[model samples]
Target: MKTMVQIVDYAERGQSLYIQLAVTDGETEKRISGEVRFLGELLYGELVHDKKSPLSEQARMDTIAYLKAHFGR
Candidate 1:
């Protein structure tokens, strides 16, 4: 099943960058809203059991692009 990820919002706390996402499996969609944490090149994310989506992958890639374009990381 394919997944879609949408960034809802984000926040920064100390050394951690957090993001909230609305994810769906293209069918039987659930709010299943969750957050992810980014630290340097490492990223940690929460996923609902059996609700697998490409949240971590997209978040990492997108965040990297964001940093490179905006912050020149």
Candidate 2:
């Protein structure tokens, strides 16, 4: 599925960032807002778990890929 990702907010947190993202795949949409901490060249974080974000594991990974493409180390 083709997905779209947009950065809604970017908050600085020392060496990391707390980001708010809007992720969509035409029909379904989700809000992925969380803090991302990088270790060396790797980024680790989780998507916000709530009723509004009924996304599958694959969807969440895709969203992360998009986020990384835009704002990764």
Candidate 3:
């Protein structure tokens, strides 16, 4: 068995962080996935979790306000 994985790139935008990664097992295969992460809000960033939660109008507005104030960007 082999193992190797590392973050190739990342970008920060307010309350969101976009991440790119390169993963390999030192064999003959590679995998990749992209995702957005919200600070202090795991469910808000997760695909499965977010879908279960409520992304209501109020929730979106609140998130905007939070990101603007916390990240100042």
Which candidate wins on TM-score?
Answer: 2
- The segments of candidate 1 whose C-alpha lies over 4 angstroms from its true place after superposition are 27-31, 48-73
Candidate 3, superposed: residue stretches over 4 Å from native: 25-73
Clashes of each: 0, 0, 0
lDDT values, one for every candidate: 0.54, 0.59, 0.42
- Two-way TM-score contest, 2 vs 3, winner: 2
Error of 1 at 49 (Å): 9.7
* RMSD of every prediction: 5.9, 4.3, 12.1
lDDT of 2 by residue, 1-73 (tens): 5566667777766776666666664345544444444444566555533333455656666776776667755
Candidate 2: where are CA atoms >4 Å away?
Answer: 26-53
Could you tell which candidate, 2 or 3, scores higher by lDDT? 2
When 1 and 2 are scored with TM-score, the better candidate is: 2
lDDT of 2 at 13: 60
Decreasing TM-score order of the candidates: 2, 1, 3
Total backbone clashes of candidate 1, pairs 3 or more residues apart or in separate chains: 0
Best by lDDT: 2
Superior candidate under lDDT, 1 versus 2:
2
